[model samples]
Target: MSKPYSVEQPERSAVDAMDGIVALEFGADWCGHCKAAQPLIQAALGAYPSVQHIKVEDGSGRKLGRSLRVKLWPTVVVLRQGQELARVVRPADEEEVRRALATAD
Candidate 1:
């Protein structure tokens, strides 16, 4: 359960192969919103067990966030077969997170 939520380091193949992937942009410990969204993201991942949940840091030196055009912290990007499906920027609560996940399908 806890294992799938593990962060996958930035790589081309890994990111490209995420068909039905849920990519989460989470910053370092200093980000308050990122921290706040962690639990909700975890729960969402738990519910969608088949979804590949990948966490990426949204701080300096992290190109992943910029590549994804993440303008806000704690951005949840959902993808289907490595394609951009839906996104939620700066989600406020678990319900929002759930809604985002629902839209991904």
Candidate 2:
């Protein structure tokens, strides 16, 4: 089973300060695109056990989402040492997600 998006999100500053490779997946549980991408995201993430993945619940008035300018569902922003390396929005397949994750490698 896939994990549900968490409403308790870390501040953008905190995220920006994070160390190592991190995957910030911004989406909502009710979003179809988000749901469809879960498996692909998980499969790709499995190959990179060192990577930290944070599933964030996003919607209107969500500060983290707003600050990140997340306007779409299932935006996987891959970061390396707190800096953005790549992003894949609404990935169609595991390979797409893997490609985004590859940037941090």
Candidate 3:
């Protein structure tokens, strides 16, 4: 049961993995939307425990989030080999998260 890690800069190997689902969760711990989405995100990703979930502490100073053009908290970016397949911001529906996961398969 690995949860997301609050790292400032994510590693290239983690992001650019040529295989498997890598979910970059950009958000702040204090954000309400981020907090609310956690449960749903977890549940949605529960089916795919192998998926790499990286919780980044995004803010004005977090360059990675800005580089990814993340405008909202709890922005989930599903990637494979560092290529973005899909993204969801402030997702209220579990389906959206599931959709992100499906991209890996």
Where does model 2 exceed 4 Å of error?
Answer: none
- Report RMSD (Å) for each prediction in the order shown: 3.1, 1.0, 2.5
Off by over 4 Å in 1: 1-8
lDDT string for model 2 (1-105, tens) is 398999899988889888899899999899999988899999999999999999999999999888878899999999876678998999999999999999886
Candidate 1 residues 1-105, lDDT tens each? Answer: 133223445664567666566555455555777777778778766777777666665656566766777777778888766677678877777777777777766
lDDT (CA) for every model shown? 0.67, 0.90, 0.82
Report model 1's TM-score to 2 decimal places: 0.76
lDDT of 3: 0.82
Mark the 10 consecutive residues where model 3 has the least summed lDDT.
Answer: 1-10
Clashing pairs in 3: none
Question: What is the C-alpha lDDT profile of model 3 across 6-104, one tens digit per residue?
Answer: 865765554685467788898877788988898889899888899878888888866778778999888999888788989999999898899878977
The number of the candidate with the highest lDDT is 2
TM-scores of all candidate predictions against the true structure: 0.76, 0.94, 0.86
Model 3 C-alpha RMSD to native: 2.5
Q: Candidate 1 vs candidate 3: which has greater lDDT?
A: 3
Each candidate structure's count of clashing pairs: 2, 0, 0
Q: What count of clashes does model 2 give?
A: 0
In terms of lDDT, model 2 sits at: 0.90
